[model samples]
Target: MNAETASPILAPPLITFDRVSRHFGGAQGVTALDDVSLSIRRGEMVAIVGASGSGKSTLMNILGCLDRPSGGRLLIDGQDVSALDTDALAALRNRRFGFVFQRYNLLHGLSAAENVEMPAIYAGRPAEERRRAAHRLLGRLGLQDRAGHRPSELSGGQQQRVSIARALVNDADIILADEPTGALDEAAGAEVLALLDALHAEGRTIIIVTHDPTVAAHAGRRIRIRDGRVVADEGDDRRGSPATAEAAPCRPGRSGPVRLLGDVASAGRMAFRSLAINPLRTLLTLLGVVIGVASVIAMLAIGDGGREATLRRIAEMGTNLITVRAGAPGIRSLADLTSLTIGDIEALSEIRGLAAISPERNLRTTLRVGNRDYTTMAQGVWPDLLVARSRQLAAGSFFTRDDIRSYAAVMVLGQSVADILFPGQDPIGRQVLAGRVPFEVIGVLAPRGVSGGGTDQDDVVLIPLSSGFMRLLGRSHVSSVTLKVADAGDMERVADEIDRILFDRHHIRNYQIRSSTAAQIIMSDSQRSFALLLGAVAAISLVVGGIGVMNIMLVGVTERTREIGIRMATGARRRDVLIQFNVEAIAVCGLGGVIGVGLGLGSAVWLRRLGFDVLITPMPAVMAFSCAFLTGLVFGWLPARKAAGMDPVRALAAG
Candidate 1:
């Protein structure tokens, strides 16, 4: 039996459309396909010919399952195609049909072989098998030498051939070619048509849509569609019928190679490659996110550290310790003899829940030890003052209770004051003169670095309170009262007790009693406020970074318009286009986020080295990363939607 005689009898129609029509727009409607009905059989070569606006491309879309008929029964391989939803249509297209567009829709960053593997990738083929199949298809298409070349590096003809190879990679039953030779020269066009013919001979169904009569002449049957209707259906004598061609040496079915965990790995690899291709833009877009993350982390770390240090210092002072300083009475000085007396401290000490109370007075005077004389602030208090203030003695011993009772001239010098007065000599047991009175130095205080308020507590002198009040100042007044309570939880009650005691003893009313816990709380609240302020400033940068991402993604959509059009024309669903572009944007922003995190941590380390007490703990790092990724998603969504919703025909025309 000759190849030309047996085609129609052996071939089974794979596609059938019964009175299908598609319309666009709302209210004022435009009909894209009007009552179109057609049938395409397996193992047959058919062409659809029409001028622009004749609905040939629309019919091709319906045939490829890219778009559905508005009001008709469409069937593919005896299955009701029009009844399937969008996702089902996409799955059917992936499993049963392949598409080849005039403008090759290869990813710009990928090599030719990678582009050919895309359909199989969408079909969820394993990596190794997909790669092997892609290589085979490329080799078969006479593009083995150009397999590693990017789309930009290939000629228009070569790109089209790669697209053809991709269409066949899935081994789909139907191949829909929409002006497959439109972008090629005569020589390349003839070569592509020959490839299609060879595939048709292998018992594969092929449909070509074109306006060129010469292109349609190669098919065994040609269907002329005009105004959304089939104007002519004619069988050509030049090309033999499909049935006899199917009996000839058929090409062996190619099975894709199986790979373990292929989908995630392949998508990640593609994402990485795409990012590597545009380094500068990715870096700039991530700058804001990085700055925001780093700033928030650093600020919080510093604030927390400072708060912890302050609280530790306060705890060391004594868990339930409280201080009462005599403020100026209207216009009177704190040192005025008419204000506080020793009776006030004795009264406060006798209150319930009170542990101890010490009266204190401060004097600004010059200290002289041997030949060295320096000016320093002196705090006058009893022997119990050291215990309430949590002072640590570095050398010698603190003043005894006997010294306070006998009014002995004794003093404790802070580290800095000791260094200044004694120089290289030991200050313990040495006599130091404060203004006119002389006192024996009993101890040298330990070094306590800078406090939260930047005050150097190691630059003062301590003396017996009675000696400072009676002998030096020649008065019985006290500057402040220090008290320790039995329980921290009873701080408010104890404070009230002390206030009542002082008010009763001095015959005064409306006096305030402050606790150390309140001070600590105030300090912490202030620090938290500062941290929030810093975070707000940093958030502005993140917003700017998000804007940068949105702008770049919009630009990317514009730049890849033709690529998007080609993908859509090749049976990619609207959601698929949306996801692909969104993934690309996410990939770019994610790369930026990774780089920013590294930089932020590095900056924290650098600041710590500069003595700024910075800590980039795990929580802050995690928060930073989360912020970066979220920014990408929030900013990249609109542009991705724009790219996905673009009209394929108009997008292709844009180029």
Candidate 2:
């Protein structure tokens, strides 16, 4: 029926539902609302009455803009609402309608004034203006004395009254009440009905959906629905005459542009307060993240230190030196040569770019001084071996060219060997037995610490190569050849040349040549593999941490469902609801990441003090931060979406 057939038109209808039907699930699903048609004019008080399962609540949902009609044209202030998407619909709901529910739907942790101010906050109202509007509305609703009370502290009727003030705070043109008196006792319900009557008297457009005939009697017009269709429309005498009145002019409220900013600030404050209240949970959450970060940092630091030390030791051994030992291909093993003769040394010296060449040979033998005998490594080399091999003599003198020519029985002992043979006495002039052969102790080499392979260099005796070969262990072949290249840059080329020369001399083909670069490559590959393995392990821990964040956020959403319903019922758009919860999740994760970084750095320092080389590089820190932030954003999506996509009616019904 048209407006003229029912009653004389005063102002344009604020809302109209034309042949609307909504269904759930697939094509065979049940219909929630079917072929419902109605119109509501500005400054009109209408009641939708029905028993349970009469489609009354579904109609209310459409009117409040909570759901879109599956079929039909629905209009609000001449705008076809059925054509809007989810975001546009939410925007229209926020800007054009106000809702009051039966259970009050107040945010449990917020004060009465804050609850009222929520709509203005979502409308982007400035803080001071929102405060002033909230205060004015609360005062108008007679809640000024109860502004600081939380929902739990207020009576049912008072809570509903606070919700009404929140609805009106946005100064919306239409007020939709869905079972507003349902949870109240007779006395409280009567007070709420009277309040609605008063607002209608002030020329506000009000729609109330209720099952009680007494509540419906207060409306200017009554529409009764059954089985998803409106069956009756009747005018009530108590609502005054419709024809004699002029339309009330719409007045725009003050700008609320900063409302969203205020809401963000408030949500942040609440998050901080919650964290402070549950200190133990917060600390425990941070602990998991902290340990993961600390392990990563310490491992890196130690690896870095070890790499540096190795490089330093390589430099000290002299980059110009090239050593050749007899070993299987790809494996380093000592050669079993009887001697490296003067002829072999001369042959190596003839190679181009060779600075020096020395024949090195060693034997495991016992040295006897008086009654004491000690087992030691007896090495034989050229007079220039000290300079060629980077050895330093600490006492007396190293063997000279004359000593080599004379085949002298004089020996230069390493620091460890000297200590054992001489004890506290000077052995420079004393003679010692080398495998029962008399040999004079002439010099002692300085102590050299252990190598990377854990071998001590200061446990040997040095004698002239000629004397070691002719007098002690008489054989022709040398153990190995040690060469000093003229130029360090030519080491690779010279090593190749040497390999060729030795292979030609021995009549062997395909001999492998080892170099420092090969050793470096092996070490680098090992480190990279180890680092990747450790990083994968760390990533797993991060995933667990992310899951923890998601679980907690889901719980938060469940606990705050009523709060979400209240905000949506006011003027909050779905995005506002989504953002508030998302921000809270991100704040929690970000805070945990920062604490983790601090702990990681501290752990690295502690490891360094314990003599483990660790390198906590900036890359890990950046990666850790990114992981934490992204964990919050990615995992928080499901819970935040659940909160945002909630049906306001169902949410309020939850309590």
Candidate 3:
């Protein structure tokens, strides 16, 4: 190859069109650009003059990468536009095309400087660099003083100038101005035209789309477009095939981690500013998420608390223990006593693996202490119960073996019974009459408030077995036999043995013998399933909240359709728009999550104060917050995609 041929000193044309066509509908639809072939060399100042319905605007849309050609391929600096995805196309526009429009298209929430820094933001420029570039460009454009002012605060001419500064922020290679001075007065319009002339003189490719002859005169070359066709051209029409042309080396836009962070920051700021536009609506939307998350956490907390309490109760009753009732549940009165007798209990106590037995019988009668008459429940139990049931003595010693054998009329009052019978005095030696039978109070059991089964644990009296059966109740058979087995693993075997011994002795089919451990397992499993069901119901709120977010975002996309188009025309990638909307949704959900966690915890505390069990673990809150964030992402995607897929020409016209 010749040295000159391989030198790579000469560059391809900056922009090209190969018989490009842009049509709106099917065969009978409007043809915006019909078989338009064009190419502009680097630094050329070309004017595309056309009437309102002409194809100049359509050509501009294609050149800016805001719209695609229907019939032919477009090439930028020898790179086929069709080969790049939506995001890559946006990156190219951000780096190469600077746009100035008649409507200005300045973001209302951003200051002049910030609006000028937008393309740089997409270009992965840091905050400091974007600010520095914006200031420098504003100074050059004679709008330095207006840099901090928003578009609404600036005059029409000032807004137009700020937009020009924005177009130049990334040092874009091509400046596409669509009636740049159409909205300005004669003096202001002349100033903008002169600015364009200066930029053209500095070797920046300038393309101005306009119908006015006065504006067209400022360009070095004029191309007239009529009926979606280029009727005339005054500049180079040379075109190169994109497939064969040497491709220009372009930087992969913002690919590094640092650049990714910068883009995230930009999206965050934009989303936040957009939220500020409708504060009440944002708050309402956030409220939905907060309530949903709080409900989930709170419901789980309550369910877990109840389950834990029940488990503790079951655990308190020794797992190695077994309970045998005379008859099935609901066997209440002594008159309804079953075939169970003291002889049957004595036989069961001899079974292998049997550790100890406590035959309990109860009597309910009006007992008199001093001049006060009160009704109390009395249980006939032995001293062995103190260790077997984990009971503690508050005062005095329990009855010995002699008390049961002699049928002594002595009793030990529960804490609740003592409080009612003795009041502020000691009950260790007090005599209380039970159903006209006098009984001596020997000791007081310490308070055991309430059991897991909702039974009042502190409201009974314990006396000797002989006293309750012979003296108090005057019954022959015992109430129930509770046995403690030697090995926890043998509890099941011992329960079956008791059932077999009782069935043979009583010659009755009605009886029940159960292991507390089995009951614990059944209770735990049932409670767990219930908690899960409750959580699932609460989770429905999260779904509803996510739907609300999607609805709001969809409305936002509709309301800001024009703004999205403006950004697209100014070199924003489709991903940039998508990220911006997603950022907004996530921000809402994240903030709501924080608030919801606090609310859930506070609610738990309040419920506990009201005597309800509430277990507040970090897992539920974390899971709820995570779900809320994911909800935003899932729901926000549709609106973001819709915004990204919009047609720039149609959007701008709607605005």
Could you tell me every candidate's TM-score relative to the true structure? Answer: 0.87, 0.76, 0.88
- Between candidates 1 and 3, the one scoring higher on TM-score is 3
lDDT: worst 10-residue window of model 2: 244-253
In candidate 1, what are the lDDT values of residues 194-301, reduced to their tens digit? 888888766677899999999999887899988778889999423234443332221232333432244435556775785678888667666666676666666666
lDDT (Cα, 0-100) at 211 in candidate 1:
96
Q: Give Cα-based local distance difference scores for all models.
A: 0.75, 0.75, 0.81
In Å, residue 338's CA in model 1 sits off its true spot by: 4.8
Q: Give the residue spans of candidate 3 off by over 4 A.
A: 1-13, 234-254, 312-321, 327-338, 341-343, 352-356, 386-397, 400-409, 433-440, 449-455, 467-476, 485-489, 503-511, 514-526
lDDT of 2 by residue, 380-482 (tens): 8887677666778788988788998899999998888888888898879889899979898888887877777888788889889889988776775566667
Put the candidates in TM-score order, highest first.
3, 1, 2
TM-score of predicted structure 1: 0.87
Name the candidate, 2 or 3, with the larger TM-score value.
Answer: 3
* Candidate 3 C-alpha lDDT tens digits along 418-496: 8987889988877888888898888888787788668878898888888777877676677677888879888777878
Error of 2 at 652 (Å): 4.2
Q: Judged by TM-score, which candidate is best?
A: 3
**What TM-score, to 2 decimals, does candidate 3 have?**
0.88
